[model samples]
Target: MDGPRTLVVSGASRGIGRHVAMRAQAAGWRVIGLARQTDAGAPFEMRACDVADSAAVRETFRALRGEPRLHGLVNAAGIASMNLLLATPPETMRRLVEVNLLGTMYCCAEMGRLLARRRGGRIVNFSTIAVALGLRGEAAYVAAKSGVEGFSRAFAREMADFAVTVNTIAPGPVETDLIRHVPKGQIDAIVARQVVPRMAEAEDVWQLVAFLLGDAAAMMSGQVLHVGGA
Candidate 1:
């Protein structure tokens, strides 16, 4: 029998990232979860690492060099602030860029290199539908996720030869703390624009993830899939 494939999901402590890690583990992947805190008695093996800190990410992956080969990485670690370009604080903008964009870059660099060496793996980077819709009051958040979308496409090309498919998922707002700060009216408006007119469930996203990480997605790379139903 084949051993369980290993997956690393950053920001696994909460929100969509946590959902992804939990579901993946249930599906038989040996999951290593990364977050700011290492809580006691988590279901999967958890590691504390700040994705925004490149050095920390590097060292964390270095420690994992002795573990099972990493077959997948989910760059789900991100932060967001909803505000107009003028009203948004500089500090909030900086944090959004740092955690959402820079953090994804750091993990991809470290994990991408490792997967390239092995010549096979999968990478899924979280993006937001705001990039396509240009949602108001989310200038910083949209910009940051835009960077993720762009990076995933180019990275996919670079990794294609190694059979490491890189893809980005741009999901509309889900019922997670990630959007808890947004006004209910705002979320309803966004949902109305979707063809399905509803919030995304974790399962909806995971169905896509399962295919991306499986053998079926070998020919699919450099793609941005929208679960937004727009």
Candidate 2:
């Protein structure tokens, strides 16, 4: 709700996370980007962090304790998986959960604790429309994203009294590196199914994230907003 605030955005090296961090800075918010790689174009401070690493994440937050209090958190780090359930390697599925589900949970827990101390903050988590649309060959991804959704809702409930809002953004088909490995035919089919008749852009999703983190969305919480372009 404040005019200028600090926001911690995960996966800010690229894709929707990158756009959100850049846009937030442009809007006068101080942005902190967390990723495994440094981003040359990041508008604010950049911290190379692997969200999947619990110890590293804890240390990162501890190091930031003396800085300005965080006003928002965006959990945008994620991994994609697409394969027949029977053919999908068990290890691959485990990794997917580790990165997508567990990573988000870790960030939320740490960030939520800090935000609660401030008595007000916002959290925007990344989910997937695949969880709602039930795309084939995406059982693992869908499951992980679904876990994110559930976690966001429950976390929202637990943090509401503190004025910390938590919500999930379920994006459809966004043009990002994560989708590069997806078959072209499948990508085309997904686009064809959209009412917009084109892939969702990272900027498009970033707008929603900005809104959620802004004062205009203060009344909302525990919602799974679907940016399916449908």
Candidate 3:
């Protein structure tokens, strides 16, 4: 059977989300990319909005309601902050939660409603391997990602009877701007910790996301798929 014909990917200006959007477009799906900035190089329709703002997300979805069929949603808009539990400021922590967790909730809530009306769709939420591995300076990030895992599972259960599959992808050490601040030695140490002895590439994570949004992943839902060399 043919898979979904349309896909909506957030954070598509760069990194894994960009890769996913490009790959999905290449595979003949109509792609709509949501990001805070517009990149002239982007190959799909770029919608500028901060997913952290509930009103903006709702307005974007409302504008997209005219489309005949919306099949997939990738919640990839995220913000990363690294700080010790004692050193992290209250506002910083709140910002991380707002962007990584609340933003995801807003996107999922809005998109899930549309998918529910159609009786079928897929949602791929982004989590982090830090949530599982427990890094030293990622207290806020870990907490937010952990929340994302729980949220994805619960939402998946709620959407199951409607044939909407919601899943989370917990990726480890991908080479993106998110890691630009890490020391070279620290980067090497992280790669060594992985069984593959290398960091994941943007495309590496995108492949799994593509699978989840594709027909082959119809049976999978409410699960967190970890993408790491180990």
- Cα RMSDs of all predictions? 1.1, 1.8, 1.8
Q: Candidate 2 on 41-160: residue-level lDDT in tens?
A: 666889989998998888877776655657899999888978988899999999899899999998988887888888999999999878877888999988899999999999999999
List where candidate 3 sits over 4 angstroms from the true fold.
1-4
Listed in order, each prediction's TM-score against the native is 0.97, 0.94, 0.95
Q: Candidate 2's error at 77, in angstroms?
A: 0.6
* Candidate 2 residue pairs in clash (backbone atoms < 3 Å): none
Instruction: Rate residue 150 of model 2 by lDDT.
Output: 97
Mind giving the per-residue lDDT tens digits that candidate 3 earns over 144-164?
Answer: 999999999999999998899
For candidate 3, the 10 contiguous residues with the lowest summed lDDT are: 189-198
lDDT of candidate model 3 versus the reference: 0.88
| Best lDDT among the predictions, by candidate number | 1
Ranked by TM-score, top first: 1, 3, 2
Could you say which candidate leads in TM-score? 1
What is the alpha-carbon lDDT for the whole of candidate 1? 0.90
Model 1 lDDT tens row, 1-230? 36898999999998888889999999999999999898667788899999989999999987777656679999889888888999988899988999999999899989988898888999999898888889998889999999999999998999998999999999998888989989999999999898778888978988898899898999999899989665
Indicate whether candidate 1 or candidate 2 has the larger lDDT.
Answer: 1
